[model samples]
Target: MAVRILHTADWHIGQTINGWDRTFEHAFFFKELKEIVVREAVDAVLISGDVFDNQNPSAEGMRMLFHALADLRRARPHLTTVMTAGNHDPAGRLEAPGILLEEIGVSAVGMILQKDGGLDLSRHLVPLKNAEGVIEAYCLALPFPRASDLPTLTGESAKEAGSPIVRAVADLYQRAVSGAREQIGDAPLVAMGHLHVSGGDESEASERRILIGGEHAVPATVFDESLAYVALGHLHKPQRVGRDTVRYSGSPFPLSVSELNYKHGVDIIELDGDSYSYERHALTRPVPFYRLKGKDGLLVAEVEGALEALELDADLPVEQQPFVHVDLRRQTSALGLRAEVDQILSRYPVRDTGVSIVSAKEEGQAAPSEIVSLKKLEEIKPLDLFYTAFEKEHGEGPEARHLELFHSVLAEID
Candidate 1:
């Protein structure tokens, strides 16, 4: 019998689009995910990381997560879920309810710590068992390792340790794999990680760089050929690392405008004896993402025309509507243009809107000119200094409202 698993990562449950809440989209995605789990008859689900958009997630976000997990568990009582902590997650918070969640067949590993100041391999290794109580596979659940999470080397040992942080992380995986081999005989090994792997394509606008001293990404060689599959996270774009077996399932939703072109989905892995095979399952996006840009000569008019031509179904829920990002190329302030665009989009069924203006004249160049003043720090007023910097960047002085806010901040400081 084959053990089936559904792999996903970077749900970003508390994420927002231009200050607009995305609770509905998340709920809809979960509904679709639940159907997939049931339809596929998956034995286990692995969420690599970034379960929330921020470390300090909102109350609504927490509620949605618990409810979603409950629904998944209710659908399949024997189903097991393993979620690790990414850079966006608060490890301690995610792991606080670990004991209770483990009782319900959900293992959440936030931070891996050493027991008695030594590597405790048991904490990071999890064995996957079938409904009949047969151990079929073992998973090395390695969460995003912080600087503190890695084992420390001091005194004599520090001298011999080359790249202590990377070495400790690699050693952790090695130890976990070794332990799994000993405990579960002939069971296919599956490793889950929430860190950047060498050669993985990244979405700069979405992913937070996890590199440390320019030496963060771990090589795929650390995983070795012993592991049947490696589920990775952090990178928002789904891709392979060194081989197809070691891959990132990617984020379930587009976290940024730059990620609009990505085909968001999940991975399905089938474990048969010692061999494993996997396939990508494309997800039904709750909301379509689109980017519309204004041409060189027809700046505002082009943007307006595009917005007017967008076809949307008003009968559907707002979450199902399109998300529009309008890019304008202009010489003057495009701030006022936002209201005009909003007015036009208001007639449509779009859920959210964002406007970005790039100067047509200075398209690929730096700011018009550099501030070459030689004034000392104490010689200038804070407000004037702010105005100088703002003018240099935007090619305009600060507005009345901006000045007011600056004064208010100064007053508060005083």
Candidate 2:
């Protein structure tokens, strides 16, 4: 049976922690995704995981997601959609098989596995059917690998670098794949899962996992050769791990400035019996949120040059404005650093941007009061100083009540 599919992941809707309005970016992501699905005539769409940044998304977030999915299913009723939960996700809640979603022909293998890593396969394996409703393939749904799942492997905890999480995770994945294959039988099997497959790109969100020791990174080989293609997720960069057979569709949008240079989009995979080929559908290139630091005059010159060069790529629409993070370095004696940045923001069509000023001191110049006269404000709380000077000189009413309460609490401890 010939199979055509679109692979994509990490649509963190309503994610505003990073300063950009993920809501707006998410809408753009789906708009582009729909075009890919329609353009490729996909038989299925696989979302590896992290559909929402948090377990409970905002109302607008949920509405946007449901509307998009409903629209896609409405346009293509026969399209089989599959998704799983990632480490960033609350797996048990997100992975549970939902009847409402299933009714719409969307099969979610979210958080159904127990903490011990055991899965009930009765509902996990979906026999893929053609547009004519004939069985054509099979799907094995695997959620993110958890430490609880591998009781047999002895190892150190994530805090201990020498611990066995790596070995244990690798073994668990081996067992899961083996078991899933046995349950799947002879049909051309496709494994859709939410885990890092060793080679995909890591953004700020994923960086926390890689840095702290508790996470599992699996080798691509854990997936058996019997599988036609392993649709993996968690990483934000579209990548082929060890071999082209195991690939990540990557995040649909840039998750952070760390992923600024990454090519954002989905993957179109064509499965022909024993072989498969894939192509990347480039979504719009996002504006790089930058942090630039230099002397005042040089910083302004560079900012001007950067603005002149900010042209939209062919994949991106012109109206999609870019964001920037600008920093200025100036001698303490040098003046008007704030004014210069304000001037830049006023002149540019920057969607979201911030400029920071760095103070430099010459050998004989007196230090600025903010830096050198720290003794004058040493008795004051940093919050109070900032608020009293800048925040409308807040009157000592309800606003100052909380400040007093905070001071009282600290005073008791002192």
Candidate 3:
């Protein structure tokens, strides 16, 4: 039996803390998802992890996701939706009221699997039989690995071996996959997990700090032959791990400008019997926001040229204007920068971007003396300046002393 599925992950709902509005992007993401399901005639949809930005999403965000899921269920009654919880989710929120998800025809594998010690692996072995009685495939839902859950790795002093965290995580994943295999029977299993795995090409979104010998990531080799394909999460860039069998289906929206160049989309996997092949579906973003670094005159002209030229591409819409990241390198005061950007923002009517003033000093200029003046203050980093000003405004006790030390260290010409 052929198993046609939509592979997607990292919805990251309620992720509006950054400069961009995630709500808008996610709204479009689901719309595109809906279109994909209808166009592809999908059998099931697999969301690897990070469904919600945080456990407690805003009421509006919840409503938006709920409505989208509801629409999917209504459109495709036979389509099974499989999802798992990522590190961002609160375990309790996904675990409670599990029955409600069944009614909606969305099989969420998050907190459900982790409840009552571990997953009832047997339940997943049963192949998903369609309306035509054709057995599609088996889905093994594993929640985000936690050190406390793996009984085999029990030891308070495990860290003495050096890189204890990496060993412990590997052990947990091995055990989990082993248990999943027993229940897998003869069905082609697709394991949906929410931990960082090795072998993918790292882009801007892939810029994250993984601890040394810690739970930074797991290798795709862990999945091995047991899983025909491993749908992964945590990293926001779509990439292949190991033998292309394991893949991280990156976030739908450009969360940061770092991800501006990444092709955000879903995977359309076509399964023939036990073997499968897949292709990427490119998503359409509203605007192409970019960071242009140059002098003042050059920066303004480039933005203007881009704005005027963008309209020629019929696929690109006016509202989808490129958000400008103005990095002007010139000798300008903070007040002057504020005024310049403000003028541009008003004239261009660009509501979705920002600017940064990076002053460029000529080489071999004499460095300033110890007594820091208001004019020299502009040379210091914005973060340093803010903290120093904060200390000056509010009498320094503990935090002020720390800020002063930071300011002094930063001011030194290294």
State candidate 1's TM-score. Answer: 0.80
| TM-score of each predicted structure versus truth | 0.80, 0.72, 0.74
Q: Give the per-residue lDDT digits (tens) of candidate 2, residues 128-201.
A: 66666666677777766544445544334444554365665555556656667777666677887776666665
Instruction: Give the best candidate by TM-score.
Output: 1
State candidate 2's TM-score: 0.72
lDDT winner between 2 and 3, please give it.
3
Backbone collision tally, model 2: 8
lDDT for residue 212 in candidate 2, whole number 0-100: 17
Clashes per candidate, residues 3 or more apart or on different chains: 0, 8, 0
Q: What ranking emerges by TM-score with the best candidate at the front?
A: 1, 3, 2
Every candidate's CA RMSD: 8.9, 10.5, 9.4
lDDT (Cα) of model 1: 0.75
lDDT of 1 by residue, 1-414 (tens): 778888999999888766667787789889989999998888889999889876666788888988888889899888889999887776777899888887778888888767765546577777776666576787888887776666677777668746666676787788777766777656788999888888888884566446343355778887858898999989989888999899898888787777887888889999989767888888888877887764432366565577666765679877667887766656366456766666666777775446655553344765552212222344344645776687678765554345446756776786
Whole-model lDDT per candidate:
0.75, 0.62, 0.63
Tell me how far the alpha carbon of residue 19 in candidate 3 is from the true structure, in angstroms, after superposition: 5.1
